[model samples]
Target: MKILLATDGSSHAQAAESLLTSLPVPSDSELCLVAVVEAPTWQSDVASEHAALREELAGYRREVEERLEREVERLKSRFGRVSGVVLSGNVVEQICQLATDRQADLIVAGARGGSKIRRWLLGGTSDRLARHAPCDVLVVRPRDDSAEPARGLKRVLVAIDGSASSRGAVERLASLPLGEECEVIVFQVLAVVRSFRMDIVEQSGDLWEAERRQAHDDLNWAADRLRPVTPHVRTVLHEAEYVADEILTVAEEHRADLIVVGHQGRSRVSQFLLGSVSSAVLRHAESSVWVVRTEDADVS
Candidate 1:
């Protein structure tokens, strides 16, 4: 497998590196560690300040390159192949382009980076990359202080909604080289729209029952598909008004190390017009989140 590890030299990035090391990827898998250096803008045109700016940029470039090389060397000791690259451009666009050029199977990144203000003003790199990347994206959140120390990728929680995108997520999970010890919990959240009137409840009882049965069928189908990948598999059906909240609650209850969900494959314009559920989970989930995009989606 080919994997792209995007870094910004922050503590969060280091945590992502640690998470990657814990995964059970093939020995022949290749890892590329990339760092993006955004172009800087100056507010003044003073000659001395311009020279100072140039010197500062050059020093920063050197520091970043050195740090990237060290990281590559460290990964090389574990994996059979590892490489590092330093690029300049828009951070999100450059990372996506690199992933496309390499035909990477997965892209891994830290959920938060060095610049809090920039991330707040512009959406974080992990969020944008997950929305736009050509392949799957794994966003690693920082370790929670209250939770116990996790040994590795043991428990995984996947949310399914009976969409093609959801099926694609299951297929991706099955294709991964997770070890035998890994346990997978396939969960489906059934949204119940309630009416306050007693007459409406009586009229919709049959429809509600049918919907519940369909949800159970879908959950069982997903579980069956995952059985070949790992022996330890289970299914859960949750009914809630809010799907994302229910997913997070189940993940916490399971003590999951990873949460996998499908991207709705909404275009940039439509995504802005209609909000995304995957984006909400990506932003709020405490566990590492993997947003899988279908192959038919336009990755550009």
Candidate 2:
């Protein structure tokens, strides 16, 4: 496996690095460490007048490169092949392009980065990468100072709908080398959509019951697909108005260390419900999130 890790030397980035140690990767796996230095947008129009600014930018870039080198050296002790690079440009684009160029199987990054305003308006680096990366993206949240680090892939929660993308997420989890002791919980949420008050009082009751049964069956199907990967597989069917909220609630109740979901699921009335749900979970979940992109997705 080839993994690309994007860092900005923040505590969140350090959390991602710490979490990498617990993942079950092949012994010969390679790791690529990357850091991006943002080029200053405010420079004098005249080239001669901007010489000092260019020098300052060069110095900053060198510092970033040295930091990445140190991080790579530290990770080399754990991974067989570790390398580092410093890229200059937009953080999200450069990271994604590097991941594609390296043919990375997975991209690991922190949920939040150095810039607050950009994260507020444009979403964090991890959020954008999860949406656009060619491969699976793991968004690692900073661990609570008082909490203990995970030992291994102990408890995992996966959100599943009947979409091909959701099944793709299941397949990806099944392909991972999670140990026998790993426990996986397959969760599916049934959203109750009501058009009118009369529907809510009359038609909604029967519809809810029917949906519950179908959700149970769907959860079973997802659990079966994951059975070969681990024996401790469980399933949960939840009925809620908000799918993402239910998912996060269950994950917190289960104390899940990782939450896995597809980037998009079946479209309803031409709207992609899973996309919004996945985005919400990515932004708010306390556990690490693994956003799986289907093979049919336009990775470019």
TM-score of every model versus the real structure: 0.87, 0.87
Q: Candidate 2: where is the Cα deviation over 4 Å?
A: 43-49, 115-122, 145-149, 200-210, 267-275, 297-300
* Native-referenced Cα lDDT, model 2: 0.80
Clash tally, candidates in order: 0, 0
Whole-model lDDT per candidate: 0.79, 0.80
Relative to the unseen true structure, what is the C-alpha lDDT of residue 163 in candidate 2, on a scale of 0 to 100?
76
Write one digit per residue (lDDT tens) for candidate 1, span 1-300.
Answer: 899998877767787888888877777889999988875677798999989877876777788899999999889976879999999778889999999999998898887777321342115677888878888899887657322226678999988877667788898888766768999999888765565888876887788798778878988898888888788899998888767788889998888889998886322113211035788788888888988878753443
State the lDDT of candidate 2 residue by residue for 70-126, as single tens digits.
898888878989999888888889988998898998999877666321231216567
- Root-mean-square deviation of Cα positions for candidate 2 versus the true structure, in angstroms: 3.1
Candidate 2 clash pair list:
none
lDDT, residue 167, model 1: 84
All predictions: root-mean-square deviation over Cα? 3.8, 3.1
Lowest lDDT sum, 10 consecutive residues, model 1, at: 265-274
